[model samples]
Target: MPKQNSIAITGAGIAGLSLAIRLRQTGHSVQIFEARPREASGEGAFLTLAPNGINALRALGLAERVSSLGIPTTGIEILNAAGRRLALLDEREAQRQAGAASITLRRADLLEALRQTASAQGVDIRYDHALIDIERKADGVTLRFGNGESAHAHWLAGCDGVWSRTRRLALPASPEPLYTGLTGTGGFLDCPHVPSSGGVLRLMFGESAFFGYIKAQEGPVFWFDSFTLDEETAIGRPDPAALAARTRAQHAGDAAPVRDIAAAVTSVPRAYPVFDMGHLPRWFDDRVVLLGDAAHAVSPHAGQGASMAIEDAVVLAACLTAYGAPSRAFRAYETLRRDRVEHIVRISRRRGAKKQAKGPVALFLRDLLLPLLLPFDAKTTQAVQRYRADLDPLVLPAA
Candidate 1:
């Protein structure tokens, strides 16, 4: 049997936990370090995992488990500010092609599932051990923690998020995450007046902002709003009540449903400023490499951030299994992922730009062009949704 590799993964997120699970399945010794406490680490809003992401989870024998916890999204309904339907992107055909339906669920649920699975698979996860420094040595890499502790491992994977400490310590020259000038706020509401769409995502392109909602079979309506802001106006965080008021005001004049949904938000809405990292020149240094959001933080407009991270975990593990040597496997992993992730990032940026459309002319052009352009958008969705990581044996013999 081949000698098992000792890998230290920074971040117990979807990427890190999934990577740990896959590595352990392949007989690797893996440990995870997370900055936040285990209980607090799972705090996040809901997200949609496309079919491609589902397929990646399937590789880990987790698709069925995740699907059970999420609502299966069948299609998307695009609407104008006046509640007029613009275009419908049906997922029936895409699901047929992809062999799975896209799913939307709370980010916390998915993280919890990954964490439990990782633990069951014998991954040693330590929370509240934020990585503070990384040093490459002759024999291995040393990881320093903020808790006045340190450890060494033969290989290190930076599955930490956008503001990754590993990325900073390992590749200081890498580009930082750029603020996209769009702020997102969302919350759940039980508005009986708002009819359920039976798992279809309803999205509206308003004059000054964007609104989206979907209904689970039994839960409250899931809704989100995004709008552009000037750098100067995007100062300190707004409290939940203030954010709710701002969101309601932004979409108040758009449509009845928009107003109704905004008013229906009973709980204080949480806010997040959107950010993304563009193409990175490199994703690794020696035995240390970056994964998922640490390597490419895609804008949320494309709704593939988590999916991309899941795909990265599967591909990275397969590469490591094929190559044995950390450097070679990391290079192959980057080669397989960079182009795909970069393309998604570009598409997300374009989508975000359209969502942040301002001025009468831009809004007019968007309303006019969206219907004609939706067919192409559907085609792109097919391509993205049908992606499958090729985890077959590499042509090169294993080292």
Candidate 2:
């Protein structure tokens, strides 16, 4: 364990809470500041937890809770517009290599698990407290929150969302998030028509859009359709039903599962344009640092956002534990994580391009060739999933 220090983490999302839990366990005092007033109770759409993420959670000792909520994958079946099986992913081989199966669950379930673990670990979570500013001195950092409160700590870490206040303060000249020419409109639907032994997750690629649905427990499965939008086409926050209708109109092809899923969604769908920014020159300045989406907000196309966040949380805590002092820990974190995170960010963009490709020829190639290429692709996937956080690495004492 490292020398104890009072640490303040902004954003009570997956990364922040996980870090808070880990830090407190290793004999550090941790406090989490969240903008939302209390934990989010909204039912989240579906999310897949890759083995690397599962390993991080296992390290945090919440693996059982996560597995309990998870619907295991026998395998992944990729189908075409006519529902013909195009490709199959050998989930068994993947699991054997990683030592754990990829698990899919409602996003809310994962967040609740993180929140409960963090709270149970004695991490003080202060909700409704937005981070406004930070003052980093030679010795420590002082953080000012929106609620007219301030806290001084030996170190501060930002696990805030994509639009991070900490990032703006740390790197004021960084470029804004760039849209990747695709808009993802996602939500859950109670469609019993989609067979659910909880067998295979379905993905359909077409000229105008890509539709995906995953089975979940308790009868509410989730689906997301990614559509290529022109610059003028607005993918803004609107009524879910209205957005579904608009999305249906955008795809003028032989859409079966796509149309059915859209019409089945009773709950409002949420639409967000996918965007990712390249790595900043630095993730830490003195006693302040960034983690998770705050550090690298990769596109969802990579299907590694949650996994990456969980990895970041565990690794950040590990670096701090290994280094002890704020300055040294922050530097080690940047050195170890910057390249990996930046590489994933770029990979995610490429994955999105493959999914958002237009025309029947492009669709046939993506839907057909990509699956056949899984043997090769699995190697890339394993490289991303096999990361091990160096929590117990050697450290030099404070000079």
Candidate 3:
């Protein structure tokens, strides 16, 4: 494909691949450069795709294929370490709120499916080509990869994620992502002995940490947890075995299966610090623009990371296709997404705060107040699930 007809994207994660498919189907030459190997496995634990996320995937013609790869998640059951029920946020209600319930599946599986779909749709996806720098051009931008290769396109989309090099190279003064002082690790266990969660995810707000798990009808159990990291944490890429032991130690004496599931782990685990950049002064510089996590990195507690990215892909593609000029298109895209994504980011931070380890007094207060506040929380959850990728074809810049 000639440079004149091409658009380059960084990071082949959910946002990049979704954007590639959207652009390619509209006759643009799209290419994605991913830093990871072709395998693209060993990603984080499972993720639950909410209804709004499904709507975005539907816009890209991927809802059917992606949902086929995942099991429907009915709801999340909240509990205290003392084994007391807090509340059940039923996803079945999502049908009325957003026309569908959430689906739960391994994060890696979703990424792989998107990658294959993009490739099949004639999008050039080059793995191990981590982006390093970008040089401005008269008509477009030049992307430099760490592999010593270069590509030029009429415009660039930085779907690269929170620490996006495209954002760093393009917007030098942009604020850095602030660590939420929380880090976590999680993995799956193929244990059938553990009692089923009865179609809902059982989330234990353990005395020392938080853990969540759900057993497939007759399959394996999907689980994960959230824990804080010590300032200047010295965890230096511990392997699976080491990570598992540490997780078990952190969650010791929580409850049944908190320890049991930790022992039966066979899935690849993820360990990292969580960060959210809900606010960014800008999202584009000339022909270079940011999308998805690159623009608004929210914590996974919000359950909107993938959904928001897919939403960004749809809106960004629509703006570029409709507005033609990058300047006008980028402005329109930012106007449409900034408020919503930032709001979700703030909500995610609040959700994360609720799970942090608390003292006995705080714990008592939480247990006492959670039930009273349950009704309001449910309304918020329903609203989050009700959002849609309802982009108007003729977008006017936000006043």
**lDDT of candidate model 1 versus the reference:** 0.85
Once fitted onto the true fold, the runs of candidate 3 whose alpha carbons sit more than 4 angstroms away are 1-4, 40-42, 266-270, 390-399
The parts of candidate 2 lying over 4 Å away from their true place are: 1-4, 39-44, 216-218, 230-235, 248-256, 364-368, 390-399
Question: How much is the lDDT of residue 372 in candidate 2?
Answer: 69
List, residue by residue over 1-399, the lDDT tens digit for candidate 2: 212488888998888988888887778888898887774533346778877778778778887789788787656766666667777676677676776778888788888888888888888888888888888765677889888998887778898878889889877876667778887777767777765736467777654577777775456666777777654454456677777676666544535666666666554546777778775777887767888888888888777888878877777777776677777878887776777778778878877877767677877677768766866766777777665443332222110
lDDT of 3: 0.80
lDDT of 1 by residue, 1-399 (tens): 112388899999989998999889988899999999988888667899998898889878899999998888999999989888889887877787888889999888899899889999999999999888887777788889989999888879999999999998899999989999998877678777777778899999875689999987667788888888664555466677777778777787888777788876644545677889977899997778999999999889999999989888988889887787888999998888887888889989988988877778987888899999989977886887777763342332111
What is the lDDT, from 0 to 100, of the residue 277 in candidate 2? 77
C-alpha positional error of residue 26 in candidate 1 after TM-score superposition, expressed in Å: 0.7
Best-fitting candidate, scored by TM-score: 1
Compose the digit string of candidate 3's lDDT tens values, residues 1-399.
336658999998889998998888778899888877877523677888888888778877888788887778788888898778888877686655677668888888888888888989999988889888888879788888889999889889999888898899999899998888777776567787888777788888886778888887787888887777764662455476666766777667766777677656543344777888947999997788899889999898878899889888888888887888888889999988887888789888988988884898888888888888977876776776676774352343231
Pick by lDDT: 2 or 3, better one: 3
Error of 1 at 93 (Å): 1.3
Query: Which candidate number maximizes lDDT?
Result: 1
